[model samples]
Target: MNWKIWKKKNDHKKKKTKTREWVDAIVFAVVAATIIRVFFIEAYTIPSGSMEKSLLIGDFLFVSKVNYGARIPMTPLAFPFAHHTMPLTGTKAYWDGIQWKYHRLPGLSEIKRNDVVVFNLPVGDTVALENQEPSYYNLIRQSDWKTVNSQYTITSRPVDKRENIIKRCIGIPGDVVSMKSGIMSINGKIDPLKNTGQMPYKIKLTTGNVNFEVFSNLGFKVSEMQQLDGETYLANATSEMIQKLKPLDFVKSVELYVESPSTNDGDLFPLDPKRKWNVDNFGPVKIPAKGWTVKIDSNTMPLYYRAIRTYEGNKVEQKAGAWYINDKVATNYTFKMNYYWMMGDNRHNSTDSRYWGFVPEDHVVGKALFIWMSFDSEGSFLHKIRWGRLFRGIH
Candidate 1:
């Protein structure tokens, strides 16, 4: 045997073996990450100020799947890291080749009211193509919906594939929830508002220079301010700040700028013209729990219609003043899944349960545990890190 020839062959084999080992390691890492994400916990970023002071923009969170029980993957064939779409490519990251039915792994506790939660956006079922000015829904409402539908690919996504949104659960299963003049009451009791709950206030200023520092010092985000006249201005404010501003020397009078119920918005859930429920003054509607039965009629239809048809996955219809569930003539319908009412802590600015109705149990992702990191996009380098917010527990 030639020792030199044997040495060359041995060295070549070692190189190939090393390459295969590297590939194996990479595959293993990806698989482990996917499992942890689907069953344990996942990272999320606050993309908007919907939750505002409670959960701010630029705050990064570690959501715990174990809080409300980890939802079994309804859309399991997705890309390893991506949730819905591939980055940059703007294509569906998940494959519909295999989809599992709704199931949840047991968790430490049930979802309680006021828990900051992450779930799929129920109304994001449709989206527009390129060249929409403001929003896809806004563009659809401008003119004939049929024309807009023709141009865009309207996709009805599964419970899990829809966009992920985080909000505070204001009303849980079996709770009667309502908002009265921007104040939330649940089950006939004034549900204590979160520290960050906010609404718009119309302020009448006396003959004096407006103090911007006073609003900031009093802990108001002060989203927008428009001077209507020399003395009056409309601005957004937190509940506490609104009270604080009312007694201020510069402020003559302060009142909530409530939206009229008659003013119809296309974005409201149920999309019914008869129900004059506005964001500021919305329902005393009951949240549906599993096995709960309710009598159905014209009055109740608008409330639970979407819950039965879309959320619970049933075909409901009304004929000759009678209600039917799944093609069966019936007076009452039983809910198949637990439903929640979620609202942004920043009440005035949030697109939440007030607009889109209940969030189905299957759509529940996790409880927001902590803000691991925080950044301020609008702040300079020294001010970028929100020092007080880092590693803070989400209330």
Candidate 2:
């Protein structure tokens, strides 16, 4: 071979080798990241103020997938780092051509009540909008059903591919959950987390100007307060904060502000006017446990209908007012999976299980471990870092 030709060939081989090395490194990095995310832990940032004092907006957390068992990927074929949508392009990151059944590896502990948990949104399986802004469930109810149905495209998502939501798990499997005038009761007992959760309170001022300064001074969100009347203001506050307000000289009364249950809000689960359950006054309904069976009838079917058909993967219908499951005329439903009730710490502002129904076991992602880093977007550079919130353990 000519000397020049041989020298050119050697140069090309070196360039090819370098390209192969770079490709190998890229592949390794992607694989390692995906493994870490799926099995050990993954990072999540608080996008909204739903968790407020417990978890602030801009707080970045390291969620532990192993705490309640790492869920095996149901929709495994996807872009490595993205959750559901491909960043920038706004397209689906996953391909659902091949899907797997729900499975989880044994974990450190079971999900207990009041544990701040991260799970896939229950009503997120079907979305009418691309971004799914306020939440599909709320959007549909708030808008004219026929208008929305005709105007927007509806997309379906698999269990794992749905949007992720973080909230405090208030009810576990088989536990009866109810909210009496903004107070959560589990299995006939008031939730012990009264001091931690936030709810709207009517603060009636007896005398003097509204001391709005006191709210900010006490670390309460001033934006959450709304002036209802001259002396009366509605504020979303924690039980501890309500105690502080009650003792104030200018404050005449501090009472929990509950919406009238008689007013049929179609936004609530079941969407049946007869249920008469509102956000502040909700269920005594039981969370379904694995293998738990319930006798279904016209009265009970409305509550568990979504769970039976959507979550548990059963075809259910009513013929001549008699319920049928999986084409069989059945009066009883044996739950195939466990279910949980999740609610935001900031109750009035959150769209959670109260609006949608129970969260199925298959949708459980992981338990929120702690804040690794926190940023305050509303603050200046020097004050941006929430130093106190950094590395704080999540309850």
Candidate 3:
């Protein structure tokens, strides 16, 4: 009825509308950014030396999500009570059509060798990390880190007790990788291990027990060892030893050895075992393939239960001790996840695929596109920046 009052009311309505528009804009931006992260690129940081030379410690990288084709949102599961269900009718049978189908992504090709990749650790979870199998503890403890920097403080995340390592791919599925000295090989082809001579010395194994080495490379040592039968096989050895040993012989069982790793402060990582040599000393072994399923027996069972089946699916037979697919016993899937054998260019000092077996297929998350940024998890963020590695491409 009153013109002045009508005009005031209209102005109030316009203010409310503007507020809603701003809220909508903010929400839209957040959702759009999340979508891009889920289906496109993801950022990751390198925290360990396992992938040294290729990816330095503290180097941050952008991982391409679409490279391997994104796994369709199987219910788009998220943290906490979020899960897929019948949304409209309030039903729970939301995703019953094949339990989330996996498309091979026809347009996207499979992984190739020498491609730097990010993958989950071979273990599904760190469940096995609890057990202190001498070898298991050695592998974890020997990594160049500590639970606490000095005392009382948690140096890094406990769940990340094991390193989320970055390494260069040295082998792929169906490829026979061989290494000698610092050299590497695939399918009988050799990748010469360069003697960078930059490694340190720390411990040696005169007996089965780990002890400090008196000197450098001169001492007979087997660093980072695994038990084979009664004797201690070198965790690292030279290729000459692999070539010298007969099939299934002691030499075949023996691993490589180095002088030690305590040149500066051995506590940084595990002291070098008496065995300085590594895969280089051993004959080239064929990393198992996907179709080549094997019976879950004593020999193949450990690898099957752990490395193979941990990430993907496989049929297991009990007692008969055979595990395989399509009823084909005694072999493993050769190329389930496009295997990668990673190694640090610093051969003598690096622990890589030569110690651990082949990396699986599904475990691969993405390729390291470039180093966008870096920070020392233990040091001041600005001071610890590795400037030279910034903007560097991963080979």
Best by lDDT: 2
Candidate whose TM-score is highest? 2
Q: In model 2, which runs have C-alpha deviations exceeding 4 angstroms? A: 1-18, 127-155, 208-211
Per-residue C-alpha lDDT of model 3 across residues 1-395, encoded as one tens digit per residue: 66776566557664557889999998898778767765677788766554544455678899776776654543343322212233455444333333443333332656676667666554322322223333333433353111212222112112111234555676766677665553456787765543321222222233543232421132223344345534344333333333333242222233344422322323211122432334334435556666665444444443334344334554434335344454576454443544556666546556666555567654555666788987766557577876776787766
User: Each candidate's lDDT (Cα)?
Assistant: 0.80, 0.82, 0.49
The parts of candidate 1 lying over 4 Å away from their true place are: 1-16, 127-155, 221-223, 243-247, 260-267
Rank candidates by TM-score, best first: 2, 1, 3
Give TM-scores for every candidate, taking all chains together and pairing residue i with residue i: 0.86, 0.87, 0.55
Score residue 313 of candidate 1 by CA lDDT.
66
Predicted candidate 1 versus true structure: per-residue lDDT over 92-200, tens digit per residue? 9988878898999899999998899999997756556556434555543343112234455444666798889999998889999887776778889887666576666
Error of 2 at 31 (Å): 0.8
Whichever of 1 and 2 has more lDDT, that candidate is 2
**lDDT tens per residue, model 2, 1-395:** 56775465557564557889999999999999999999999999899988866888899999999999999999989999999899999999999999999999999999898889999988746767655555555654554111244455656798898888899999999999998777789999998554667788888898647668887786677876788988888887888888777887888988878877565566687665567888888888889999999998767776787788767767776678777777889979899899999989989889988888788888888999889999998889799998998899988
lDDT of 3: 0.49
Give the residue spans of candidate 3 off by over 4 A.
1-19, 73-75, 79-109, 124-165, 193-283, 290-308, 320-337, 344-352, 375-385
